[model samples]
Target: MSHRHVAAIDAGTGSGRCVIYDLTGVAVGSAQEEWTHSAVEGVPGGLDFDTRQNGALIDRVVAAAIRDAGLGATDIGAVSTTSMREGFVLYDANGEALWACPNIDGRARVQAERLTQAGISEDVFRIAGDWVSLTAPARYHWLKEFRPDILERARYMGMLSDWMATRLTRTFFTNPSVGSSSALFDLNTRQWSDHLFERCGLDRAIAPQVVEAGTLIGHVTPESASRSGLAVGTPVIAGGADTQLALLGLGRKAGQATLVGGSFWQMTVLTDYPLVDPSRAPRTLCHARPGEWMTEGIGFLSGYALRWVRDAYFEPILSAAGSDLEAFDLIEAMASAAPIGAMGVVATTGAPMQSDNWRQPPLGFIGFDGNTPEHALGNLARAVMETGAFLANSHLQKLEELTHQRYDTIQFAGGSARGALWPQIVADVTGREIEVPVEKETTALGCAMLAAVGAGMLDSIDAAFAAMASPIERHINPDPERNKLYRDIQNNWADVTMAASRMAECDLFEPIWQPPGAKFTSMTDIRKV
Candidate 1:
């Protein structure tokens, strides 16, 4: 077969990226453009984005990447897309988007709670193989209750990746990996659940057609080709959700687990059968490949927490570098200098799991005295990194228990993997070897491999990945002493998080610092007013 380049577009939460890669998975060119996500004015916890605007940005990046590659439209053999899962767009009969909501939007929490009250969470989990979520189904529930008019007017609903594929291929479809995340799909049947639609008061007609990932949906239309700088008949392959695509991109097989550390942290294990112990809170979804499932556990606000530390504490470094790219160097250097255990400071990075009954735990810090110590900054940085490690380790341990197999090594991907200290911290804390790939954007690379499959350049997804697999750049081994130190700290963090969660349950915290036995009258009176 002749060698050719394929293009992959990733519509992520913060930005849209178009990357061009050859058969061997070497990036020829890449371009990314950011988009805005804002809260809806009248709807609390509603996050929305413009569908058409995002499509335009995707086209712009595709054009830019082609230019950077110095290749003509016909040089690209095929195109594929992957995107943030769970978010969807409501379309009218004419295929015009009425509204769009992102995964982070929690406007449907109340609706989801209603389902939980009705006591169908277990049945929902049985069918979907996932925890009850305030995602697609709950969004439909919200619309049915509050905006029945829009519900009646809408003809079709599809995930964000489906919409992007339609923009390029002029076909409306979604893959099982994307569909399963919507909380409206039956994992066993790999189709939209009729009972779920009935529960959410939705019409089954509104659901998009289901297709397998890497299947050829359609060729790029003339209009889209002109906009995106691609050949009119370029094959547009169906791609799965970003998380699943990342797994394929990292060349993960059934025996392995992967941790994708982005804005949110995710740990997924590839298994032949769906890992469906309702006791395990991890979400089980179909993999991009047939007859395989990914058991996924998610930690919100992981890498973002580190970004918070950067902007909050590393102002001088940010000023010197004038951008986040260079500021990370200083942060990593400082974190490297800090001793293990973050000097007894425990940074509780992720909140407790579903049973907490409270809102997200406050980002807490413990064991800090009033005065700033000499290693204060390093301690703070290391603590933040350690928290992320502990959170990942917690999920990894759970995954091992559920699957009855231990993972000696984990493939680490996402932007955060570019940082040096964080991966080692995770290795030491998790007591597992960490493998970092040469390419950081495994999600896009995964899409490119699927594109290769659709283009007939590779016989199968496995073949495509084997041909284009990137080499591992680093292998981080756990330090024995540090691992032991972190074991105690990880246990302590659980206690600390539980205590903070309990404190949050009681929202009344008096400022009086005296012991119960000491006199509190003076301090209480002074602070009461």
Candidate 2:
């Protein structure tokens, strides 16, 4: 049979998914399996990616997707892969996996602190458009300090997506979208920096060759084909980080902005040129497209926080409904009953993006009284949702200042966008129109677009997007009155969050979240920057 479809394998933070898409960008079949990274015993903030088990999971999903699509392996024309950024796998000289970790792994806190204290972090931000927090160098240093054997055996390193491609084709190559997250790439050149390797005491030889997204890397090997239910010699194309490709899938263009609200909320704005922030507050990342870049402001744990509220506080409703989708609808209705400001509830859960000095105070709610209507579960849930929007607004303003451009419309995607209330809140808070696409699995759709391009079914990425991108499902316009009120509420929330952060700094309360090796003595220290 002739090759008639393309496949995208996504290794996300929370799950592994395989989606098959036809030429029209419509998903024909998909399979997903949730997985978790295990915390390392006795290692503070350490999470290990079990490569052996996860690799099996990937194989299972790929085979299941093909079966679900009711198609033979020969029908898939090309395959591309995307994954959560900042997580990587190391390989030995013989290409055997040595060690792997996910993005949430923070075992290198001591090493990251040392780098920051030594002022090396500034140099890293200047060259790599990233900081030492959760980047590859600190992790590599940690391995060198604590697990020297793995470092000595490590001969090659690549991001999770690259590792997936390597599994199929036995070729190791990284694309800029994911490779740049390692804090080893020179933003100007979109390649590994020798200075960074030498300064961080890492072997430059371990870095893999960089490739642009959609570039054909290699063909699937017979061994992998047997295991993955893929045809031998099927073309394997280089893919990108999930967020970057998600932008492409949403049909975002240069000079546009998007808010990806998933486990984390990322406010990203694409630019034609790589623009580094002098303060290094926002992260700069390479776009999937060559010669393009993006500035990203992250809201940490926003989605996870929402999930926690549902599971912890709304369990009765969830259990009665018997499905998250239905239960969330009921929750949204209850939240709607709360006023625009969620009855003065200030939630300091998800922290706004601050790459230079990343940390968060204890997760809790302020401005609530016991058993009152204001302290109701509905209002509290709404506050958590509003906190996400508030953080996005802060990031958006910073992006506008850095890029010298105002975005009138914002594209919202990911799990949070599936709901009606959150998108409207984002539109109201940002004072911008929100466009939600019909497709929920945008990252997978974007990867499929790349696969289509790599297989020669589409002329270019732009062409693929034009041919395959989903239509806008709805356009949310900001309510002028609510937008004005949100501006004031957002300011109050910031002050409340800062106060909590100061409390965490003084050890009055433990920090709910802190980047690996981040140590802040006072909130004033960050403000002075």
Best by TM-score: 2
List the global CA lDDT of all models: 0.78, 0.88
Off-target runs (Cα >4 Å) in candidate 1 are: 1-3, 315-317, 320-325, 352-359, 364-367, 370-374, 507-529
Predicted model with the maximum lDDT:
2
- Candidate 2, which segments miss by more than 4 Å at Cα? 320-325, 370-375, 517-521, 524-529
lDDT of 1 by residue, 307-383 (tens): 77877878766676776656678788888988787777877556423311313445667776632666788888888
What range of 10 consecutive residues in model 2 has the weakest lDDT sum? 520-529
TM for candidate 2 is 0.95
Q: What's the true lDDT of residue 343 in model 2?
A: 80
Give the per-residue Cα lDDT of candidate 1 at 33: 89
Candidate 2 lDDT over residue span 249-302, tens digit each? 998878999999887889999988888888677899899988789889988888
Report the lDDT of model 2 for residue 364: 95
lDDT, candidate 1, equals: 0.78
**Weakest 10 consecutive residues, lDDT, candidate 1?**
520-529
